[model samples]
Target chain A: MNPILKRLGFRPDDRVVIIHADDLGMCQATIPAVAELFDAGLVSSAATMVPCAWFPAVAAYARATPSADIGVHATLTSEWDAYRWGPLSTRDPASGLLDDEGYFHRTTPAVQERARPDAVAAELHDQINRALAHGIDVTHLDSHMGSAFAPHFLPAYLAAAAHARVPPLVPRLSEERMRAVGMPEEMIAFARNIVPQLEAQGVVMVDHLIGMPLDRHEDRVETAKQLLGSLAPGLTYVIIHPAIDTPELRAIAGDWRARVADYQAFCSAELRAWVQDQGIHVIGWRPIRDVLRGA
Target chain B: MNPILKRLGFRPDDRVVIIHADDLGMCQATIPAVAELFDAGLVSSAATMVPCAWFPAVAAYARATPSADIGVHATLTSEWDAYRWGPLSTRDPASGLLDDEGYFHRTTPAVQERARPDAVAAELHDQINRALAHGIDVTHLDSHMGSAFAPHFLPAYLAAAAHARVPPLVPRLSEERMRAVGMPEEMIAFARNIVPQLEAQGVVMVDHLIGMPLDRHEDRVETAKQLLGSLAPGLTYVIIHPAIDTPELRAIAGDWRARVADYQAFCSAELRAWVQDQGIHVIGWRPIRDVLRGA
Candidate 1:
């Protein structure tokens, strides 16, 4: 464990922030931008969508950079109208995962109503196997959308992650597990119960992580920088979607411009300086892997 | 589905490269690199490590970017010598998951012998629930270190993914699934068998993907550029990892620098120019999602 992280203090001055990139293979516009930032030492890490068509390209990169922190984006619910994917398992037609066009249904509810854990895990394994075959060295696992975390799907998600042996994005906790099963609880108590369960699960926990709203470009950047500046040293992961504004992306995604703006702000020299000024320690999975190995 | 994507074939050009950045919370070095890469629009997507201590930082970013394509890096064995994590489910002292230090043993073999799918699924669900509570918009699910893909854990991985309703990267065909079952074959045969299963499952399929050794960064980038220049283009997911270099990373990992180098080449103006020059459309999940919905 990081010495500083091992003894996390409450002071904002002793904080370490992990600036993460989301959607490496979701589109072409996003890839290059992600690359430039990492090359320039502006960002720390990024993950991929194994189900999308662009994964081969992503895998090649991961293979070449055996050490770059990488992970599987547990996917479900193809949300785009024009673009979508289905489960990797074909044994269950009753899952209702596919649409009339033979593509994955676009909504989480559709999946929730139809899919089963058996089929979902088969497909999830397929994606990871694909990455492995491609020589993509995956470092961890995460959800593509919140679909895995939904009340109905939580149990299935955990089974898959555990089977995979890769650290998941969220800590597994009994109470949280209960909540996912649709149990109602007092927010404070629920949150309180969550910590112990998480600890027991060997999950890496944190006090907070900040989110960025697409429309709020300026606020996104400001909040990100502020969050980075104000972080405590235990371990924090901050996510971002950086894409270049292009005609194709614009036509398909209305928020491409905002993503680009956020990207621009994040890669700016100012933010880098802020991180430095804040005395924040920027690190990656290699160390964590090392620490974990040593532990 | 960009009309252009439809117009193109999937053999070479038709692929959507889904390059995923894995291990978001593995260490401080990885997180920022991923975030910057996202900001730079380098890759299409990324995922998070739920078990690592730095997860909150990563998940917060996922929450902020509702549409930013992301996923869960399902975890199990902590495969490092020093840094280690164990099953969220409690283990008996005799389970042997613990290293000398009492954390979960760090390799797949160790965990494989001792882990039960039920316990695995429970942990996977807990991780997903945690991400949901933290607010992550995940796109898919996948494994870490191919642990779940191993024959011993295949069923567990499939069950979990199916239950979660997320698309697993692996295809559910005989030949393809056989790979997970340890029946390896030529790449061509593997690809051939995979297509049918993916189609039958209503799961999206990739034309092809490949991985290379880290030291062969030049070959990897050059090959990718060549591949992209001649890409078939229906929709392919290319996966990769982007990270900034640091001493901590160097000590924790071996061969990862090549990944950093590949990331550099990926974001190069020359590469971006090559992509544009070839008229290959790079996209995020929005278009892919839209197309899948339409499909």
Candidate 2:
């Protein structure tokens, strides 16, 4: 175990990390923010969404730097009114997965109702192959919009992750573990039922995951402090989405105010100072991979 | 349950669909893919990685077309070697998460050893703010490199995710669950156990997840077939990183071979035909959101 794990109260590093960035090949602002976050000490790893057109640019960057920690942002859905892509598996009109244009239908339900596992897997493989073709040294995998997790799609999801040998960012918990971690009963029962099924398929899982702070501008500092004070000694993950607001964004976004607020919080200096004051050890995905592998 | 869910399940009229594009701001390839996908009816929703350098290009596109399903790609790590970025958090030497050039360390371990949760959370929020400030809609939130799931940083991850009220793509499971899913017993769990916590916090977790296909070129087809044959019942998410290779990419990527292979697989007509023959369905995120929210 690493020395830091012990200090955090783990027995010779009982903890793990999965420092991840969302939407790798998503948009212009995201590319730099994710790259910069990774470049700086704020994050440890990031992933790329294949279907998005910007993926090549991201892939080129990844190719240029082979050692960068990258993962496949497995994409099953194409989002954006004006911009979208079809499944790597071309659509069949009969499947209804695609619209009149033959591209993917604009939502998960459409895919769920019309998409087939065969199509999903094909597109999935195609996306990965595309990344490899572009020279990306992907280390892990994740979902683009959680479409794979919707009802009736779990089986294919596990098979794909196992086939890839790439560690999945999400974990499926069991009832006992959920209880130990203080989860609600319904969740525990739900976990108990699902855990065994997921394990049977060779899927990996995690103990706990956390989300990042989402406070308004006024509450940013206090929220950060409170969250820091509540830190526990266990492998946990927090998720956040930050972006620099632009007029173009406001027009497209249903709620741009919240997004702007999040960006401000990310750029805040006070939060950084507070983290130092609290001595909370921040980490990312590489350690988590190591810890998991070591275990 | 949302009305969309009923239609998706074949118990109602009108098949609901959500064709979401996985990546938008990732790179030049992704941008075109998304645009083409949308144009071709292949996808409907998309997001952006605000921190990425190529964001300007994506932002320009979003500005011109306000209907895209654009969201913030919350960034945390800079995994690439030559390409890296720093956290929005105030630069701190103690964090030790910085790279040689003072950007976030390229590897996850380096960031884990030194990053501060408070700082991490702050930076995450700041990135969101940046997205909003730019005119990005940021419909939802997700991780770039799984930065939010870092072992020591999970608490901060949760705090940030919860604060945002946006859904995060967490798929945690317990060790025992993996056993049920056929995963090796010795493997440490990371994502499963956190399901309850995420659910309790009202954070959205994908039901299932998958990864990109790796290793052999010919094996890609069989892998896709296997993936299709064994899909489980749920919203299964499969991740992939696809990009068009170029001289620029060759200069950057150490694993140029893999990138090339991935691209080949993605563009293969055989795979697309196989998917069509298999009757697989495809969808996107917006439809899923509608189903979940009953919108």
Candidate 3:
């Protein structure tokens, strides 16, 4: 059992989970879907992509809803074919954060191969600072596409979270699990060495990080149930990408169906009732943030 | 006599000029300068670049102050080396709006050579519609870098403005003046043919368009006075790009000094008195927009 769960007032045997939605400001389709989930109390946490075109809408929502548990979805890659964004801190090609086309590289491997660690750090800080300036009471930090989890970049990611005084989504995983997620051996070694030190410094670490495959378009509700049923004791972070079904979304995203399904699955009354019936404890990042801040 | 002055309730001899600022949403430096100029009743009109990162800030200002004479600066080029943006309508490589770097081409000639007329039209409409959706009472349409003035794209520009029922910036210039501004011979001929047709439809056209050389970082106040003094006895559009002096501005714009100078020049009490002493009548785009909308 992770001692940080105990610090968060959870028992060793308790199965606490945070239902977090990623990519809140990716486009028009995302904002309404996440807002609905937050309004219905279906989602406990969400992070905004600060570099995306629709970010100001998310900033407006955060200002309007001061209690919303929103954080910076620290971005290092612009993955879409048509929709793309570059780094906020620096546009110099020497920063190695941009692809040949000047947008952030589309893949994590490309980022790992090219992005300078100092530039990564600067961008992470810039993203978080921009969110703060927009009046977001940033609750935590997380990665988009796990770009920050690259071996060369992870230190900067942790440093940014530390600097922001917020928890980062650093889930505890075995070397095999890390390798299964396509994390390089160097990153696996780095995470193993550093995560424990972070925990020792009273940083809250999740015991598990569960998420549906982004490309899988099958029934998400059933998948959610299966994942929730398999949750072990300690804190778990359940990541989702939920967006409203719209023609604009269809144009912007290749996995539009999966995103729409995630929204429906999470917002469903059946799923809400099932989580309660299963005696699972659902928590948001706010309380954890408070604990970390020693409030 | 250009009949637009009469339709706009100005006499044929009225020295009416719109003291207009371009690139209001290009960066943070622009917003405050334009807002102050508008507040001080110095500058008469301004337009925003919808694709710029700071566009939402401009939208927020427009929403808060509904009477600001803001228009869409129809953008087809992202000229900055580090700071760049792409089209909103579509990001398909085939759209020809984007250069090899996936941003709008860095030069007007590149846009003229590669951009499809259909793509240019779609993007123009998208920029306008986006500003409208954000609560901007869009007052007029103008081109960025004169990209729309290309002979092939001029028709699309006119069509977009006609569809939106807003006046577009069509300045009546002689072949000599057009050639002096580096207008292609084809564009010069095209404008000569189309200006009369547009004027017949009651679209307000400026008798003269005056702007300082973008590369010239001289005493802008003296230049402004000279230009105002030389205004022909008809409606003139005096275009300026004003921005507050900031280190960020210094980074984003090569002509930061000139931009700051423009802001200072327009906001100066001396310049205001000089314009008044010369009997220059300052107006904004709102009245023209109202006339076009038949309000």
Going through the candidates in order, the fraction of native interface contacts each one reproduces equals 0.00, 0.00, 0.02
User: Can you tell me which runs of candidate 2 are displaced by over 4 Å?
Assistant: A1-19, A94-96, A99-106, A172-191, A196-203, A212-232, A255-257, A260-264, A267-273, A276-281, A287-295, B1-295
Local accuracy of candidate 1 as per-residue lDDT tens digits, A116-201: 76667666776676566667666666676556655456556656655655555663234655476554565335446655675576
Per residue, candidate 1 scores C-alpha lDDT tens digits across B94-135 of 534445433445776667667665666666675665566667
lDDT of each: 0.59, 0.56, 0.84
lDDT of 2: 0.56
The digit string of per-residue lDDT tens for model 3 on B112-148 reads 9999999898888878887888788988999998889
Residue A100 CA error for candidate 1 (Å)? 4.7
Number of the top candidate by DockQ?
3
The TM-score ranking, best first, is 3, 1, 2
Q: Residues A101-161, candidate 3, lDDT per residue (tens digit)? A: 5568999889988999999999999789878887899999999988897767878998999
Rank ordering of all candidates by lDDT, starting from the highest: 3, 1, 2
lDDT of residue A124 for candidate 1: 70
True contacts kept of 2: 0.00
Cα error of candidate 2 at position A22, Å: 1.4
* TM per prediction: 0.46, 0.44, 0.57
Report the lDDT tens digits of candidate 2 across residue range A1-295: 3333453355633444444566665544456556565554544567787765457568777866665677788887665543345544343455345654334566666677677776676666766776776787666667765666544566666556556556565555445655775655854566567766754654455555554543444565465466556755455554555444543343334444544454455456676566656655566554444454454
Provide the lowest-lDDT 10-residue window in model 1 chain A.
A82-91
Which one wins on TM-score? Answer: 3
RMSD, one per candidate, in order: 17.6, 25.6, 16.2
Segments of candidate 1 deviating more than 4 angstroms = A1-4, A7-13, A99-101, A171-195, A218-223, A230-233, B1-295
